[model samples]
Every structure is written in C-alpha cells, then in structure tokens.
Target chain A: MAPPHDEVADSRDRAWGLRVGTEADGTEARQPVMADVARLAGVSHQTVSRVLNGAPHVRPGTRARVLAAIRELDYRPNSAARALVTRRSQTLGVVSFDSTLYGPASTLDGIERAARTAGYFVSVAGLRSLDSRSVQEAVDRLRDQGVEGVAVIAPQISAVGALAKLSSAVPVVAVGAGSRSRLPMVSFDNRAGAEVATRHLLDLGHRTVHHLAGPVGWTEGRDRQDGWRQALEAGGARVSRIGGGDWSARSGYEAGRRIAHDPEVTAVFCANDHMALGLLRALREAGRAVPGEISVVGFDDIPEAAYFTPPLTTVRQDFGELGRRALELLLEEIEGVDRPRHPVRISPETVLRRSTGPARRT
Target chain B: MAPPHDEVADSRDRAWGLRVGTEADGTEARQPVMADVARLAGVSHQTVSRVLNGAPHVRPGTRARVLAAIRELDYRPNSAARALVTRRSQTLGVVSFDSTLYGPASTLDGIERAARTAGYFVSVAGLRSLDSRSVQEAVDRLRDQGVEGVAVIAPQISAVGALAKLSSAVPVVAVGAGSRSRLPMVSFDNRAGAEVATRHLLDLGHRTVHHLAGPVGWTEGRDRQDGWRQALEAGGARVSRIGGGDWSARSGYEAGRRIAHDPEVTAVFCANDHMALGLLRALREAGRAVPGEISVVGFDDIPEAAYFTPPLTTVRQDFGELGRRALELLLEEIEGVDRPRHPVRISPETVLRRSTGPARRT
Candidate 1:
C-alpha cells in the first residue's frame, strides 16, 4: 500500500503553480505551451504535436526545428494533462532482488537510463526475499500504481518460476532468467561465456579445470557450471567440481584454500572476478605462482578485474545493453506490436589478460 | 506532467469494484475495501475508518483486530483516489549520481527498502552529469510526476553545489554532501572513518602513511583525506600524499607502482577498499609484502575487504542506515514537523582484520 501523499499538499500545490512561471515574485509566467513551441519553431501546432508524438507525416526539417525550440525553452509537456488524454501513466515498474550485487545493480542502472531515454519514469521495488508470495505482492502493488509495463530482474530460478505463474495485465519482461522462460526475457550468454573460459584453460594445456561456482538457485551460476561441465566432458578431460561459493570473495577464498593445497590442481575458473581475487590471494599465500604453477579464469570482467595482481582473464557481460534491449522489447509489447515471444540473448566476450596461461610442464 | 490514466479506465474501474467482493472466475474478486474489513473485524465502518486514519480513539485490542483483518484481506486503500482527496502522489523521488558504484548502489538499495517499509513507492532518476542543468532537468521530470519528496545522493562538489542552488517545492534531503549544506542532509562520517583508519596504522608504530584518495570533487574522498591528514599531523608524522586514484583498482595500481619503489613508505591508507585491493596487488608485484614490510588500511569495509589476501582492516560505513535516516528526516519535514535544519551524521566504525600490523623494524 502506498503511503498518503497529502501530508505536504499545501506546499506542493504552491510549487506546482510556480513550476510553470520563472518569476522570482511568484508571478504567473507559465511554462511554454505547445502553441508557444509551434510559434517559435515557425510550424503549425499540429506539426509540433506530430513531432512530439513521433508521427511519420512531419517533415524532417520541421521536426528538427520543433525539437530545437523545445530544447531552447526547456519545454516539458505537462505529464498530468498528457496522462489524462492518453490514459497511460508512461511509467514502468521494475522488480529486482539482491539489488546490491554487481550484475543486478548494473542491470537496474541500465533500465533506469533506458527508461529515461524513452521518456518513461521507472518505479523500482526491491525484494528482500525470492519467495513467491513476495513477488506476487510486489507485482500487485505496482499494478495498483498503474504502470504501463514491468521488468523483473529475475536471476534466481524461484523468481522466474513465480513470474511464470503470475499473470499481469501489462507487458512484462524478465532479465537474466535464461532462454527457456515463457515470458519475454533478456539474458547474457552465460553458458557460452563459461564454456569459453573453460576452453581457454583447456587450450592452455591444463588437463582439467576446477570450478568455483556462484550460489545455488541463480540461473547464471547454474548455466555457467553446466557449460563448464559440458566443455570438460567434450574434451574428455577429468572434471573436478569444487564446493560452490556464495558469489563473495570470502567464499572464494575459503574454496581457494582447499584447492591450493591439492597438488593435482593446476587451473581454476571462478564464476566472477571478486572470487578470482580471493583465489589469486589464496594461491599466492600458498606459494603457488599464478600461470607458472596454476592458471585461473573468471567470469564478469568487473572494473576491478583488470587490476588484480596479475590482471584477470574473464568474460564481460554488457548489462546496460541488456537493459536497453529489455526495455525496447517491453515497449513493443506495451505499444501493441505483434512481435513473437522469444528470449533475447546478448553475447558475452572473453577478455584475455595475464591470469590464464599455458600450464607448466609437470 | 503525469501521463493520462484513462487508457485502462474501464478495466481499472472494474478492478476497483472486484476489490470489495469475492466472486469466482477471478473477475468478480476485488481488493477488500474498508467496509469489508470492518465486517470481517466485526466492527462499525466508522471504527475501521478511525483505525485506518490513526485517530487514537480506538482501544488496543480493537486496533489489533482491525489491523489483522486488513492484513488477512491484503487490503490496500486506493492510492489514486486518496491522492485525489489529499493531492498527494504517495511517491518519493531519488536523484542519484553514479548509480553503479558500491556505495551509491548500496545506498539506493537501502532507500528502496526503507521506502517500501514506509508504504511509499520509490521513483529514481539517475544523473549522467553533475552539471546544474542536468540536475535541474532530472528534478523537474520527477516533479512533473508529482513525487511527494526527494532524496538526492550528491557525492561530488559540483553536485552538492548544484543541489544547494536549486529551490525545490518538495522536502529534499541530500546524502553524503558533508554537514555544511543548508538543506536537511544525512551523511556518513567519512572524516572520522579515515582518521580512525590512519590512526590505527600510526598506533601500530608506522613512521608515516601514504594516502590514496578518490577522484576530485567527491566529498567522501576529500573528507577522508582530510581525516588522514589530521591524524598524521596530530601524531607528528610525515604525510606522503601520493597522487590519488579515481576509486578504481587500476588507478590504485598506478599509484601503488610509484609508492612501492619508495623505500621510506611504510603504511598506506586507501580511500576505498577497491583501491586498497589494487594497492595490495601492486605491492605484491613490486615484491613488498603487506604488513610484513608495509601496512595498508582502507575505508568502506566492503564485503570483499575481509577476503583480500591477508584480509583488510578498514572503516565501515552503514549506507543502509544513512538511507533510512535520510528518508525518515525527509518524511518528518514533508509531514510538516518543525524539526531543526541540520545534517544527521552516522558514525563509522573500524573492522579489525589482518591488513594492518606493527611497523617492521627498520
């Protein structure tokens, strides 16, 4: 339930009137209306309206002039009046879980940026848990607010399942929920990224690579682990699955401790860069030189990855691109476009640095 | 200008009716209204109204029963209707710059959590630049959408200055802009945190400490540096001001490269843990062991800090608590509470880890 907004009604109402007029004395100067823009642009009011609505009939030169005048006057069409005419809020709701994590956080940032560019406001609801009830409640709350569409950053399996079970009146898109989802989804090539990282170590002459996975329930983690296992088996190399970490450096360090002590361990592939930092530290402390005694690779070439002791070789996920694409897809659905439902997979690229090298002669 | 709300007027109207009834086929079902809640609690409609309005006349047991009925029915009062009566939006706008960094990201997550708990929706607008034009435009956009109040997470000097010059109609709170601003503000004690981190090394018997600061314009960076300088001056120790980093591991590595060659440098305090991670790596590459030869401490005890090679002894700022406090203060002001105009400062604490140790015998 949204809190009442009337607490500051008096002050807010006064400010609303002042917003249109620029006079310091609170004179009624009024913001530039559509007619003012049309007059300044030397175009018909209908043409200016056409430009604003992105209609195809307006000439390019006239559109340019109208846009220039709008920018010059800092014209913002009154959203309330527009909402009344169109009966659309032009706002999108986003449901995100574990929003502090790099991937989710980056995705959320991307969504906000893209939404703004598309002339839409973003309302975000961060979930503390992945329970089905919580997901339903969040959607219901957003629905009550009358958003045009929704984007759920559902990385966890449970979250995706809950989303699939729920029905929304507006268009909905899920980010990072894998390709098998029933709803429109956008995801990075998590499986292929892990496969490339694993294969990089294999090509470096490491017989097999040890895996340090992210926490269970995350689709990305599971997909990456599957890819690693697939690559190892395809190469006929022995596969060693280490206990998974909770996508934290501490968990990576703890996992690295056990791997460092094993003489047979020659190479490792962590799910993310933070864990790779821990792995590097563990190997260094154990007196095992990186690349000389062991090779390491990580996923998600986070900003700090390049500065890791020996620099890190990892896969990069373009979260911003994902967000942009997701918004575009959601908008298409909201605008009543008859596009087919299919998952949009953004490709991931491997970033080679000093972290991975040819296995030394035993 | 808020968008029109007439597009789904028919469906929404029907939903409003169903909210009070429990008919099958899901079409007849509606959110429980106050009347329904009253009936379920075996109380008069006026009594339910009194409970909802917090009139203070209801007995404790009756209040509990009303609340329980409300909860069981998942009743949410129609915010739009309420807004019509009270002229409130029931939404809070957040203006944040650099929404991807850990501190800012964590703070955003905290704001969302706190807003949800307070039964308010959070609308976020991310600024691409700290220029006053951009800041003003973002605020105008949110304002056009009718947000009740705003929380501006302005970390840079330009951003703080921009926020200070702007006149907002809604209650506004700036976070992390230092304590000198005229607007209500909430901030973590960056200076004290840095001072404690620097003094920890000084107390460990280090002759002097090198400082790796964040990029220029950020108040956190400047405040932390000031604290480090103050601590060194108080200890009568030489302060080596190495060129600052942009709060990134790459910049930290570059700064560390210069510091590692100087044999006189015995301790270093990084403005952030990310920079500290890079510093540790640079020292390791330069063959100068941490603590064994030189000690290092960092601010912002990030989750990965403890997982650094020897773990990091750093200062921790409660970003979530800061967000919560900022929202609380903004709400008070919005509710017309006559609170004093001053910044609310949250203290920082040092987490003892293995990053710092006694100075090595020269």
Candidate 2:
C-alpha cells in the first residue's frame, strides 16, 4: 500500500510546516544539561537521565513528561560526551535555501515540525549561496551545533551537486534536490504533477498547453518542464516555445504580458502558483476570458491559490509528507536503521477549480 | 539623526527574507576548528587564528579571506574554547514563530542576510507555539546552539509577554513583538501604517473606512485596529464594527462575503495583502467593482500585490531595514555597546495603485 510519491491528497490537514528534531549531540561547550530538563519537567536530573536511557522502573507518564521537557529544551546529548547509552542529543540540523518560495519553505517547515513532534530541536543553517564550499561549510556549521543528522532542503542545481560529494559523520538526507542525486533524498513528483496539469488542459480541447517555466538551473523547474514536454509528446500535441521567469510574481507578470498576446495560446500551465497569479492578471488585462478563451493550470496549491479571481486549478504538493519522510529517513540513519537508497517521490494531486475548463471555440 | 525605526522604504531591494547570523559559539563537541577555516579559505590555521584575534601580523587581504571562510563555514570559536583573544563565534541565534506570514518572514530574511554579510552564520529556532513556556523553551534551544546573542522574532501577545520576562546571558533583541514590550525590541509601527491607510480612504471622499483586522491577541492586529479607530475618530466618521480573521485569505473571503451584502460600505482597509486578495475576489463575486464603486486598501505590499487583477493599493513595511536594525542592535549588545531602551518603530508607506478610488455618488 506504500506509494513512492503520494497517490492522492489525503484528508490529514494538520497545518504542516516547521516544528523541529532528535538526538542529544551535546558538545563540550555547555548545552541543555540534564538539570535543565529536570527543572523544566519538575523532576531530578537522575530521573531525567534514567528516562533518557530507557531504564526499567520509570513510569510511562514520567517518561513521557521527561521526554517532553527534554524536547522542549532541545537537550540532545552527543554520544561522545558520555561513555554510556544515556548519551544522546535530540537534535537534527537542516540546511535550507535563501528564498521563501512556496515549495522549499514549506518542505523545511514540514521537516522541522515532524522533527519537533518526534522530540528534537531543529537547527537550521540557511545558506547564503549554494556553492560546494558554502554547502560544506554549512554541514560543518551544523556539526558545530551538534546535530545528530541533517536534512538539506535543496532544490537548486548547485546545492544538489554539492550534496552528492558531501561526507558527514552523521546521516544526511536531501529533500527535492533532484532525481539524480547520489545521496538519500525525498522529493514530490514535480514531473508527474506537470504531466497531469498538461493533460488536463489538453483534455479540455486545447491543441497544446504552453509552459511558464521557472528560471534556468532549478531542479523543480527542470522536472516540471520535462513533465510538461513529456505529456505534450504523449498526447501527440506540438511542444510550443516555453516562457520563463526567475519564479517571482513580477517576473511572471512581465512574461505573462507577452504570453497573453498570443491568440493561439488558449491553454497555459504555470510552474507554480505565484507565477500563475501573475499570468491571470495579464490575461485579465488583455480582456481574454479565463476558461472561456484560455484555460490555465498551476503547480503548488499555495494557500492563496484558492482565492484567485477564478479559483486556480493547481497541483497540490504535500510538503508535510515530504518533510516528515525526509526527517524519518535521517532519523533511521542516525539511529542505525537501514536507509533505502531510492529517493521517495510524492506524486502531486491536480485540483479541479474554475481556472481550468473546456476550451471555447476559437 | 537616525530614526528609532526606518521612516521610509529604501531603494535597496535585496529580495530579503532569511539569509542568516554570526559567531561560532561552538560547544565542546568537535566543531569547525581553525583548520576547517584554513581548509575553506585555502589558508593555514595560524593565519585563521591571527585573523580572528585581530592580530596585526596577517595581511588585510588575507584577513578578509580568512573571515570569509570563517563566515562561510560558520566557524566562530566560543570564547571558552580558547583562553587567548583568538575566540569568537560569528553566529547569531534567532527565535522565530512558525508561520510564514509576509511581515515576520521578510524580517527574518533581512536579518539573516545582514548577519551573513557581516560575517556571521544565523541559527533559527522556530517555535511550535507562542505560549510563555514555548517561548522560553525556544530561547533555551538557541542557548544550546551556543549563540552569543539572540533575536526573538515574536509577534504574538503571548510571545511578547514571555519576552518581557525573559532573562538571558546573551544579548536579545525583539523584532515585531509589539511596541508595548519591555524588552530591547525593534518593531515596525503598524499603527502608523494603518492610520495612513485609513486616512487615504477617508481623503478619497469616503465617509468612513471599515476595517478587516487580523485575529485578536496579536500586537500587530491590536495596533492596526487602534490606528484605524483613531483615524476614523479623527475624520469624524462612524467607526463600524470591525471584521477579523486569523490572517488567512479564507477568513477574509468569509468576512468580505458579509461586508459585500452591505451597500453602505464604500471603502475597506485590510490588515494584510493576502486577506485583501480574498476580499477582492469576494467583492467581484458580489458584483462590487474595485475603485469603480468600492475602494480597497491593504497592508504589506507583498510581491503578489501588484499582480492582483486591479494592482492593489497598500502599505509597504520595509522589513529589510527593520531586520538589519534588530540584528545591529543585538550585535551592539553582544559587543558590549551601551544598550538603548526605547523600541524601534518602523513606519510603513502607502503605495498608490488601482485598488482605491473616490467613493461613488450613492
């Protein structure tokens, strides 16, 4: 019953985003001592350590509260700090990108939330640049923070390339880096999502669907473009010239101004929701009726997509699942659980809305 | 004279949200050493140490590159790590709320970018909740990361109240946590922004402007409401019963639906851009024309604001400067500079666009 990528959008709308991590990777420097947890949990240091070590005779309720205190304080002890099994730092590190684009920010938030729910302090190092040197430095930074493992929310090309060669003492997982990464990673099927969106437009009687791509050098953009191209080829429709942007609403608007001019461009699939929003404005300004004259599909069912002039039809990327899976995988590796090599791909769901509809006769 | 908060938005558009911090509050756990900095900078450990200690033996160019490597790797040494002057962690800790709201997120990005540019690595601890216990725990988590200083990006009432009572060994600066907070905080004057927004509508020949406010219990929400009421009172206009939401578009749409039923309502001011967007949609659905009949204005001129069907007229909060000022304040405190007590209040500017016009004859 396990799906590589999620098959359908589930009803579990838990407001997924960043909560945080596991393991007590306490460094020689002072950190969340057992006393801190004891004070917070209204217990003694000895009792907290006893719970941490999973010793017999500790009550379940006491253990749960102690764990809660430990989690709240982010007191994960590094095993090197002590000779006993009692040592552990319930902390996980995440390497994040600079931008707050809907996809990556949500993914980071998801991982952090899952990690925190599982009793760990999530430490994030947002990279100024994704060069190999910078990525390596970030890993080093996380190591300094005493993280037991790491999750790189890297969807850019440079970051993924750097990730492939990264060597760390603890486990590391890549989220949405790309399909070709050598390290363990989890990603939603952006390609599949694009294909579905394109097919929906094609099925609406449009001869072909135009693609508004993200900027060059993005893995998500590439995957989406590939999917759109593949779907067009599969449908025996002509692959048209692709429009591009740096993935900003303004860029999308500028690109949209041009895309709106083409009378033949009756159906368009945008790379993400923000861009689609701009495209909608452009179409409206040009006096082209949406769905009536042009059918549009967008990827990433961002919260704002539903409130667009005509509610947008978009591919909903469940970052909640993606983040949880990445953290779980990292935890498995940290805790000596076997980590599967193949990347986990969550398939996006194409949501039906007024933006996409049957193409009107020219 | 320097403004307590920024008086105007600057021309510098760095696409700021979260880049991150400085100082290597490295723990006893094995971390980024001078050797690591040397490796990254392609310099020797001696040179790195010399640069760190402010020694005159190293070349200016060499010192610059070594610091770059130190920053790139987040390899700031905690003072305890070395007895000599050769210790410092170029890292700053930020305690952030979990939501990706436009205001807070932008402020965070600005801080991170400023931190990184100034040769520091930023560490963020996102809170799952804003209760006092949760806020305290977040602060404790940052302490565990070995940050020399902290910035609490707290906006909620609970978080602000907790922050007022907070005591820490490291310097702490509050960002957007409300003006009433006792802590050494920096905030944008949402009250001033709201007053200007309301005043703009009243000047446009409207009797009074109805308000769509953020959920209760938020300091920003409270401040905005206060400003709106004050502006309405000043204009001798009837202050209608306020509308509210949990700062989401859906809530705005719901509120808009109700507001749209009333023909007496000629103009409305929304708390944030996202909610305004929903209001626009609902207005259209109800056959109310933006500017043509009902003038609408919003706060937070988010990137998508301009792309809205009738490019939204709204207030723009310059988070870049706010964040930099907060970080700078924290850094000043960290470096033993005299601390200032008054909270920094940044005033937002209203950008005129197509969303607002004079009230109809009716």
TM-score of only chain B in every candidate structure: 0.80, 0.79
- Relative to the unseen true structure, what is the C-alpha lDDT of residue B77 in candidate 1, on a scale of 0 to 100? 65
User: All models: lDDT?
Assistant: 0.82, 0.77
Q: Report how far off residue B221 is in candidate 1 (Å).
A: 1.4
CAPRI rating of model 2: incorrect
Instruction: Please state the error at residue A104 of candidate 1 in Å.
Output: 0.9
Which candidate achieves the best TM-score against the true structure?
1
The iRMS of the candidates, in order, is: 6.2, 17.0
The alpha-carbon lDDT assigned to residue A59 of candidate 2 equals 88
* Residues A1-362 of candidate 1: C-alpha lDDT, one tens digit per residue: 01223344454444454333345553545556788899999988778888988999788888999999999876766565565456578789999987787888888899999999998999998876877678777877787676778899878887887787654455678888876678888999899999999999999999999999988988888999989999999999998888899888878888888889788888899988888888888887889888788888999888878777678899999888988888988887676555566789988999999988998887
Give Cα distance to truth, residue A224, candidate 1, Å. Answer: 0.7
How does candidate 2 fare on TM-score?
0.80
Scored by lDDT, the top model is 1
